[model samples]
Target: MTALRTGVTALAVLLAIVLQAALLPHVGWRGVVPNLCLLVVVAGALTRGAHFGVVLGFCAGLALDLAPPADHLAGRWALALMAVGLVAGLVRRDERPTIPVVLVTAAVASFVGASVFGLLGVVTGDPGVAVTDVLLAVVAGVAGDLIVAPLVLLPLMVLLTRFEPQRRLA
Candidate 1:
């Protein structure tokens, strides 16, 4: 069961990265793309826990940073997504997360992830982006993430739920 869940988690991250790399580049609004990988991390955090989310986020973000067409330093995304996972994981509940919870989490994750990445670029002297541009991207990213949260989160929630061992109430 653990192996199956790990495989599914890996597969989900891979799919999200592929989709983000292949498709979203074209469909993005004003150069601000929806972050599917971040959504996946948030889903993991919400379904599992902070530790799992952090690990998944670091892996997924590292993949994104290393993925082709990557312009920025690798560890930038690693740090950003780690923060996203930690924030999202903190919001998890014993009960299944509701739509409102998912939306809120998506919004917060989007903001934190984008801001962290942008800040890192500046701090590291990456010459990657301007503060105003990062602010704009953050706004757009949050909105875009919220719009797609249902599509990604719902299916992922179902999949994660399936992997859980049946709980027996004593």
Candidate 2:
């Protein structure tokens, strides 16, 4: 990975994680905070490639796992985000995504990542993680993700594209 690409992505991810952790909790709609860090992975995957996406997802998730107030079992977010990155990378390879595609990808990725985290909690015997809440989370999470996606995506894509000048903007 290019240092420039990695540094840019890292800075963005750090800002996102801080926003998600500090500010977003107060900006939620009925208690669902958007996963801002997910956008970093998505942007990287779409603009860079699958391998970069996977690595970003894993590393970013680990940062989240290590962050304060993260009480869940470690690596859950890593696995989920890695899968999101991989899937987004696959879809991005098929075509340059339109606005609709970006929205749909954000929704699906948010839902799937949250679902996987909830499922991981269940498997790990976390009583607070209700399986039924997974459905609700999917709904609420998508709305939150949709709200932030347009705001986050454009700048992120631009930065990523700068790192990879040959990449055609979608």
Candidate 3:
């Protein structure tokens, strides 16, 4: 990737995380905060490729894990988001995803990402994380993601396209 691409991606990821941890908490549905970091990785992977997605996912997930007020295990989200990025990257690299596809992708990514994190929490002896809670989170998280994905992912994808001219889809 070009320097421009790298800078833009980093900035975009930072902005998404900031907004996700700050603004979305109050504005989102009760009990569910939007996962903008996951959306960023998904957008990067879908528009860029699998490797890009995986790397971004790990970085963003680590950032989230280390962010303040995080109570869960450090690697839980990292592993989950890595899985999300891997799956997102597996989509045909040449495909220019449409709005509906992006929405569906967000939903799937959010569900998978949250599920993996919750499962890991369970395995790690977190008494508060139950299957019922996981299911609820998946439901609420997917709903919130679908609503926010278009608003956030599209612009981020546009930035990625512009920053990495050669990677822009037809």
Candidate 4:
């Protein structure tokens, strides 16, 4: 059962990554793309727990790093996303799993992810991106994640509940 759950979660994360990289760019608002990967990581963290969240975050970040239109320092994304996952998992401790929590976690995780990426860029002396660009992207990603969280979370919750009714019964 746990293996099945992990497989499903991994598939979901891969789908989210592909969609974010392929479809989201075309649907960008004012040049800001939503961080769908972050949403998936947060959702995974909330549902699964800290260790799974960290592993998922690392894999997702690695995928993002390897995808086309790459960024500098490959491992930066991996580390930043790991932090986001850990933080989101921590959030799950106090917050109930709901749309509100999903939205809030997405927003917060977006900010933290972008900030960590930006700081790493600076630390690496990469000339990097502009601070304003990073901040704007974070804000836009947060808004986009908040708007999309309920749509994704609702279906995910339904599917998970169907597969693991005991989870909901508890």
Best prediction by TM-score = 1
Each model's TM-score, in the order given? 0.94, 0.92, 0.92, 0.85
Go through the candidates in order and give each one's C-alpha lDDT. Answer: 0.88, 0.82, 0.83, 0.76
- Model 2: C-alpha RMSD to truth? 2.2
Task: Pull out the clashing pairs in model 3.
Answer: none
| 1-170: candidate 1 lDDT, tens digit per residue | 99999899889988998988889879889877789999999998888878888998999899889988887888899999999999999994667778888888889999999999999988888775788878988899898888888999878978987897787855
Candidate 1 vs candidate 4: the lDDT winner is: 1
Q: Give the alpha carbon lDDT tens digit for every residue of 1-170 in model 4.
A: 76787778778877887888789889889867777777778777777667877888898888777777775779888888898888887874654576676677777887888788777887787775777777777777778877887888667755644444254323
Displacement of the residue 122 alpha carbon in candidate 3, Å: 0.9
For all candidates, the clash counts are 0, 0, 0, 0
In terms of lDDT, the best-performing candidate is 1
Q: Which runs in model 4 stand beyond 4 Å of their true positions?
A: 92-95, 157-170
Top-down lDDT ranking? 1, 3, 2, 4
Task: List model 2 lDDT by residue over 1-170, tens digit each.
Answer: 48877788889988998899899989798778999988888888877777887888889888888788887788998988888788777774666678888778777777777887778888989888786787788788878888899999767888788788564456
